[model samples]
Target: MRTPHSHNFAGKTRVSVLLACAALLAGCKKEPAAGPVPGGDAQQGLRLVTQYQCGACHTIPGVQGAAGEQAPSLAHIGRLSYIAGGIPNHPANMMQWLRTPHAVKPGTEMPPMGLTEQEARHMAAFLYTLR
Candidate 1:
């Protein structure tokens, strides 16, 4: 008496439930992909941030007493859709922004910290893990 559409929907539901159970039973706890993200050490980046005196202008989460009033809080920077609310929020863009804030956003108040590419990458790596 049931329609073919009902049978199809029930089959789809059963498949979905089976897939979910299989995923749960598999203990899916995969670690994040290894790459530049894992390549750069967060601890090293933390040290660099302090060494560069970034806390003076920005509020960072892990760094001790890094709460500054001049800049935005980077506590959730990883989840931001854009850098400076304009450029795409990718690691490369972040590194460029960190190295040359003025170039990215001319007339901006953020100063150039004179960080090398590698250093900026390390910082970006750390920032991307903020989420």
Candidate 2:
């Protein structure tokens, strides 16, 4: 004959086990593929990067003459987990950073490139291809 306290303990144990399983599943989730971004054109993005002269600060891979050392090299930006050191490296986040970096992270050295939505998307698509 179990007491009321015993029943409560059993329930709590079940809850704890469920929570642990959920945590484990979440941890096991795979990272997203470094594929092309939807509705974005990598070729157009390359053009935009060239037009904007992003190589002036960032060392982009595909674009020729993109050998600037003032900022970090985007050799494999797609594999990176974070942008601006905090923002998640998702397509939306990357586009936002490219459009208005100051809005995403105040006082960031990356200045806003004044990119429209489509341009940002294209840029993100190209950047993701670096992986």
Candidate 3:
């Protein structure tokens, strides 16, 4: 069962995703960090959020929610709208969003946390299970 409305709806979704990703990529380029470096996993990912000061804005559960920033709470990323350049809400996209939201959606206020690709993927996996 197909309809013109469905096609139009899909188009809008795609457009939104593309715009997000483009914005992200444009904003992703920056100087890498310099340090001894810490471990990276889901636990480390949680720590990384702190290191990157994500809680300063977003209200992720298990992380400090009292930071009182304008960012949205991320208690349930899998069931959200418009992550990863409008890519459907899934684990992969969530991971990509965490790792490189600006890369995925240029001009996003969310900065790159300098997470390794692996760490980002693991964090995304953790985010999906938060629901």
Question: TM-scores of the models, in the given order?
Answer: 0.70, 0.74, 0.54
Instruction: State the TM-score for model 3.
Output: 0.54
Candidate 1, residues 1-131, lDDT tens digits: the string is 48999999999988976776586585533332212453567777888998898889889998887989899988888877786868877776788899999989998888999999889888888887786
- Candidate 3's residue-wise lDDT over 52-77, tens digit each? 66777777777765264587677766
Clashes of each: 0, 0, 14
Q: Which one is best on TM-score?
A: 2
How much does candidate 1 score in TM-score?
0.70
Residue 30 of model 3 has an lDDT of 33
* Candidate 3 Cα errors over 4 Å, as ranges: 1-41
Instruction: Give the per-residue Cα lDDT of candidate 2 at 112.
Output: 86
> Once model 2 is optimally superposed onto the true structure by TM-score, how far is the C-alpha of residue 96 displaced, in angstroms?
0.4
**Residue 72 in candidate 2, Cα distance off native in Å:** 0.8
The sequence of per-residue lDDT tens digits that candidate 2 reaches over residues 8-127 is: 999998897777658657553344534448999999999999999999998999898898998899999988888778888989889889998988999999988889999999999999
Whole-structure CA lDDT of model 1 = 0.78
